[model samples]
Target: MRFKNKVVVVTGASQNTGVAIAKRFLEEGSKVLINSNVKDDLQEVYKELSVHYKDSVMQYVADISDEAQVSAMFKALDEAYGRIDILVNNACHQGIGPTFEEIPTSFFWNVLQVNLQGTFMMSQQAVSRMLKQENKGVIVNMGSNVSKRAIHNRAAYVASKSGIDGLTKAMAIDLGPKGIRVNTVAPGYIFTNRWEVLDEAIKERRRTNIPLGVEAYGKDIADAVLFLASDEAKVINGSRLVVDGGCSAQHMPIDVDF
Candidate 1:
């Protein structure tokens, strides 16, 4: 029960990594608030585990990119739980797959608006509430290994994640004195449900890119977040923890071998 009695808010909790994080927190004794920009009947998901951890989980619907919605979310948190001890910025627009030159500025900004801007806003709001408390809190920003290396056709995502790295450092510096810790979890090649639609050839290529011979799972990233949010990481802050399966360890071949 590393997070016993803690209140954790995870954005984009409808599925994938977000759901994994929420489930992990509940297992570790944290009261979780799951958020999604779009709400759906989570009955099946809830049904599977709600019996095991009843009342430890709750759901909230909000657009993290919208200031008003974010503000309202925190307000509701204050009203419902009185304080939030953990916040996971996980919601992001998986921008259209297109080259930078072919992508529109609107599409670019929209991605930033949700990814980078939303991260900043949520951290700001969470910090404000955390400051009012005697005990400090934690904020985990989801970054990407691609943030450190530019990937083709993912300009907006890479840019936003890179921005998250900067945001994490700055927030850590500013909030450290106030007892709040901010950090980032950067993962590479995490295979989620979305990958199920990919052809076998593409899957093989993905495996090849990872030196570890396998892709990361949602639980892998969720475990990292749980550690960072726990007292075990009391000294860890402003750090970018890369959970890549060694995918970011090598450079591409300059030329194909004959």
Candidate 2:
């Protein structure tokens, strides 16, 4: 139990990667606060996780994009846990449009507000709280392969993720002196429920493009996040841990031949 007695906050834990990270932290013996903007989904996950970890879990529903709500959420966490240890900024927004021109400006800005600004807000509060603690803290921001390489139809998501990489570096430098480690876990083609309905041919094509010939499960991302948050990463800071199965390491696989 690496995280025994630690208090963890996983934003956007209603489903997918966030939930997976929360589960791992709980399993490692941390008291966890699961968060999501969706009340119904949050309540359901709260109950589901509470079955095994009733005393170690709590649910907080707050839209991370809203500053007031973010403050309130952290205030509640501080009251409950006294001090924060690890933070997984897994909350994100994907704004996809048929074409660049088709995407509304508001939608684009909303993605930035939640993905970029939300991380800033959460980290700001977490650092202040951790400053009072003896051991300090760890912050793992969720990034994407798109942060390094651009993909079509997701200009907003691409921009937001790229910003996360930059934000991770700045936060690391600023907080490293105070004993906090900051890093990012960037995943590629994580197979979530949204892709469950995709055609088999499309899925196979995606897998073929990856060097590992497989998409990541949400747990794959969680494993990377936990590593960066653990004591094992004491000297590693300001690094983007690409957990995308070598997807970022390759050039175009189709055009090049061995």
Candidate 3:
């Protein structure tokens, strides 16, 4: 119960990594605020979590990219929880296309507006609210291995994640003296909703990219965030912890023969 009595806000908690992060916090004795824009998914997850956590878990549905909605959500948090100790910016958007040039302009902008700008908007509100409260706060932004390397076709995603990492560093330096900590956890090849319906052949091929023979799970990413938000990482700030199962360590694929 490292986070016992702490109030946490996890953006994009409708499903996948968001749900995992929220669940982990609840298990660690934290009061969690789950946020997501998807109505049906949000309601479903809220009901499921409400069963286990009851009054400890709260749901706030708002698109992080929308300033008015973000403000309203924070206001609601203030009214309900009174204090926020940790914030996990786990929401993201990635537009699919074969090449950058072929991608639509609207798609490219949408990716940045949500993935990059949304991160900034949420952090701003969290920091402001934290300053007024005791214990300050901690923020963990979700980054990706695609940002480290120029992964193919996901130019917008790679760019936004890379930008978020940069934002993490900037926030850390500015907020450290203010008693707030900021960091990023970059995960590679985490198996989520997108891969749920993928063919076995595709899954096997995806595994080939990861040197560890298996991809990361949503829990792996959540565990990392929990550590960063805990007191154990008090001195740790402005760090980008890569939880990719050594995927980022590979420079070239090596042939294995029995």
lDDT of each: 0.87, 0.91, 0.91
Better of 1 and 3 by TM-score: 3
Question: What's the TM-score of each model vs. the native?
Answer: 0.94, 0.97, 0.96
Candidate 2 vs. true structure, TM-score:
0.97
In candidate 1, residue 192 scores what lDDT?
87
Per-residue lDDT over 1-258 for candidate 3, one digit per residue giving the tens place of the 0 to 100 score: 799989999998999999999999999999999999998899999999999899899888899989999999999999998889999999889656759878888888889989889999999999998998878999999998888887789898988999998999999999999999999999988888899899999889778767888998989999999999999999999999999978789886444421
Give per-residue lDDT, candidate 1, residue 125.
91
Candidate ranking (TM-score, best to worst): 2, 3, 1
Off by over 4 Å in 1: 41-49, 253-258
Off by over 4 Å in 3: 255-258
lDDT (Cα) of model 1: 0.87
Task: Work out how many backbone clashes candidate 1 has.
Answer: 0
Q: What lDDT does model 3 reach?
A: 0.91
* Structural RMSD, model 2: 1.3
Residue 190 Cα positional deviation in candidate 3, in Å, after optimal superposition: 1.1
Minimal lDDT window, size 10, model 1: 249-258
For candidate 3, give the lDDT of residue 53. Answer: 94
Q: Tens-digit lDDT track for model 1 on 62-158?
A: 8888999999888888877999899999987888588988989888999999999999999889888899988879999999998988888989988
User: Number of clashes in every candidate structure?
Assistant: 0, 0, 0
